[model samples]
Target chain A: MPTDVRLPENDLLALALDFLLSHGLNAPQGHSLARMLVDAQRDGSFSHGLQRLPGTLNTMKHPRFNRHADPAPESVSPAVVRVDAQFGFSCLAAERGIDALIGKAGTIGIGLLAVNNGFHSTALWPLVERIAAAGLVGLSMNPTHAWVAPAGGTKGLLGTNPLAFAWPRKGKPPYVFDFATSAASRADIAMHRNAGREIPDGWGLNGQGECTTDPAEVLAGAMLPFGGHKGSAIATMIELMAGPLIGDRMSRQSQDFDHGADAAPCHGELLLAFSPDIIGGAGVGEGAERLFAGFSDQGARLPGDRRYRMREVSARDGIAVSSALLQKIRSQTA
Target chain B: MPTDVRLPENDLLALALDFLLSHGLNAPQGHSLARMLVDAQRDGSFSHGLQRLPGTLNTMKHPRFNRHADPAPESVSPAVVRVDAQFGFSCLAAERGIDALIGKAGTIGIGLLAVNNGFHSTALWPLVERIAAAGLVGLSMNPTHAWVAPAGGTKGLLGTNPLAFAWPRKGKPPYVFDFATSAASRADIAMHRNAGREIPDGWGLNGQGECTTDPAEVLAGAMLPFGGHKGSAIATMIELMAGPLIGDRMSRQSQDFDHGADAAPCHGELLLAFSPDIIGGAGVGEGAERLFAGFSDQGARLPGDRRYRMREVSARDGIAVSSALLQKIRSQTA
Candidate 1:
């Protein structure tokens, strides 16, 4: 059993920042990355939160991703922009890109930003929420390492590319949805493997392309695409849009972290922001509010409401962490 | 077993259109609707193909949706347009919106269109493909009737909101992807029911909100969101964007089809078009071609490649439809 720990949000953020700083990251980079990770946990996405810190730190220690690097924005047009991550933390690059896009959209009613040459940023929902809270609709997608199989094939060929969307609703939290195109995530498979459990059929395959229950074989082979070919096609679309659209390496170009020489993970992200006011003209805000009220009346709960409530409870009661994981983190920090 | 019936592509399309016309749809409307449905089947997406036509026809007979109605474009801006579906076939309205947006985007580089007061439009991929084939990037989303359950809850509160995106690629089929936010589509549940098969756990729930394998339970309850809360959030976001953003009734304000009331089944759709030539200033076409080639090298296959191949095969051979389904369709038409 793991003991529950109650730390103030700010305290947790500062501690994370301190750890990053000690690992040679500058103040701005440390704080930005810390905020992203902490926000993921705060949003109840623990898998992408502090749990991912160790892997990120390991990558940072390698010389390929320089902590001192800065992302520079390249303007393609009034409505389009691109950012070169310079092998830095993806969280920082994503934040800059999102902020710039939101600002540009505020002026132009729509904006597009593409980020290239970066690492995995935390959960994408927080970025969506940030953009949505700014009174704009946000759409984002990113391609990562290969984990998911195509619809019919059994071998891994595509990343569990995640897509996210956010919509602002008056008097309610903005609805934020983020998900991988895979039927099951690598984390879920890892959990099953940790518990020596068998995965459900159709979730993944063995190395020989046959269905497998053993978590290890499934992990060694490929995770199935959600809803079969539909999901595979969607994931492929994300890869093309995020990878090639932004001029970054795609899944095949990605280095196998387990066997290849350590290299900067060349991930890419695409984001679009649109203002409802611009589209709806004069009474857009009022229209949105009225629409949301109608949905509430119809017994519709906002998408993120439950997660938000769970996060609030967790914050108030403190988060629970596995004892072994907590000990590992403490040892690393010490 | 499905018996293969060879038919030329043109012949299959003509036959489908003829079937629709015999059921009281006007020539243009029937042609548009038939093309959309046949395109789905040709692309190997049997669920959204002719399988849905019978239900759609049944809904059309309710008098709320006027099969002969025509959509009139309402210009919101030089680069923005709105269309009232006149409670008619959404396939017609959606195609019209796509054409209008593409035309506007050709001049402005970006076009946004919203469609309201429409009926179900099958397979969003075709619209995206149309936009992509026109040398533009396209994004679309729609909100439908409640069929998806929220993350933790077992009750139906949202439609299986589908999203589609496409991008122009050089020397290859344009990338096009379409998928619903649900773990499984209502069509999949119906298929299981027809087969007298038990569904997998987590696909849906019973009327009492308890998980069950009985396909009948799913029909009475709700389909689960893909990836739990993440998928639910996406559905909610889609509802917000597609519903209110397009000025349609939100989920709660939506009328139930079970009531057999004469109210129109309102559907909302959002379409966006972006021209690379406008965004990429000089050498835009070359840049796009280069990007496409680079992505293909990275194992990024075009989204619609498989479907296009399937269609080619079916064109060379013929469409394979189950005897039972064909007989059922013939009886309904007879």
Candidate 2:
């Protein structure tokens, strides 16, 4: 609700894409990154939106970084595909490989895509939502450098691993939600830090491993897993799934390997897509109807409902980018 | 802990098996049920242990029950199999179908087994743990009758859905745990109810839709999801996955179909097994090592570490069942 620079949706996306092009990304890569950034801004995920542009641009500027490198994930098995992003962004890799995953699941019932040496810097809902839109159940896990301590432990040994899940709904927007196994994703914390706002209590631990509500302190310290030990365990599972399971950098290694700037962080992601026709088969519609009906009976809003509503408003009235952020993005291209 | 009657491991197994046989279960089912029950006791899951044996016995006696069913699941797609338990205990069916699931995951990169028309009474850890023991990543989700309320709402619109995950460790008991998406499972609530103990705060709601600590009130009302909206979304996903995706009962339908006095509540389960060699390929060992190393670095115990330690003790010293429960089993025999 601060003072803002409001532009039409097209102009916002065009400016964002043009900024990415200024950083030497190809049209396809620019479009991919811009699309995710715009959606995040539209849905009010400011940290993952325009606020992240400068850092991503600085990271991509490294001499060792190659935005155009297409690792071209290979079919490792009938239902497995592996992509070695080789210190590049996962944006294009995911865009390139999701179709293969969908096709494999269509044929074999389920498909898995392992992404290694990638830097994924967006809210992952869009990726899985795309898979859901393709009429398949989609689930994704992405691990970053460690910032979460194991439950009842002192060290930050786990990633604030984020997971996304989506399934198709009959004649409606697909049901979807993305969450970090940790109390909050780093991006959410960063947003709080930028806003100079206090985060909710119990959201994180301080450097001394004591609970604190200061977003700045949390950024310097660690995150608490959402549901105590259970959340920590899931974070562990996701860390492995995105890390060594894909022959990629583990959270610990990624923390050590972080260059601070001019390079995407070394990390990984895992995605699974399951076809309704193959897995749900004859009962697909019935299952969807039952799920929606129950959700309605409780007057419980479905997960994707928020994003769907936000998308419509953003498309119509456009998104509000702060004047400060707009000036910063423009300065980046200067 | 309640006073118990210590019995030798062999004697306990023998008595439990005999008690199951008295209810007319075949030798295979008696062995399976007894094995799971004994393991539950061994692992200190008393709620899922011998405490609920009488209810199971009575349920199996229902005229609508079919204990001798051999629901040999049919292979739907290469990576998918569907088992209709044909209105019987899932013990024998799971025991019979597990090998096939492991084999399929070994052949393909991933395998999915859907079990419908089944009453799964035991803790699901044992099933997924078996898959992990076979050197695969195992994930299982089962949905039961309604007991959980959606986040932001107070109706029991969802099941106390349980999810289990396991991954193998080199030269170690597999790392695994199973958890209800609800704050606590229905069985856990029932245990507290029987003990006349107050449930923990945030565990459930009263009939008037207000939070309460009374287990009786929760039983009459609803259980809250473990991690607010996130857990509720996952539970919703599990409910649909185990129901329509598997051609079985959704939470509402199952609640209505449940024969109050006889037969285990009709429900369904979904299982996925992913072979490390097939999915992770050459990185399998690295993945396990990285995961275990993280736990060790933090002096953190893996999820199932307690179960493994207890199993050793139980195997050596045997489990202790309550004298009253023993008398009840004996009474059944008489």
Chain A vs. true chain A, TM-score per model, equals 0.90, 0.92
Give me the displacement of residue A185 in model 2, in angstroms.
2.9
DockQ of 2: 0.62
Q: What's the lDDT of the predicted structure labeled candidate 1?
A: 0.72
Candidate number with greatest DockQ: 2
Pairs with backbone N, CA or C atoms under 3 Å apart (clashes), candidate 1:
A298-B252, B6-B318
Query: How far off is model 2, as Cα RMSD?
Result: 2.2
Lowest-sum lDDT 10-residue window in model 1 chain A:
A255-264
TM-score of 2: 0.95
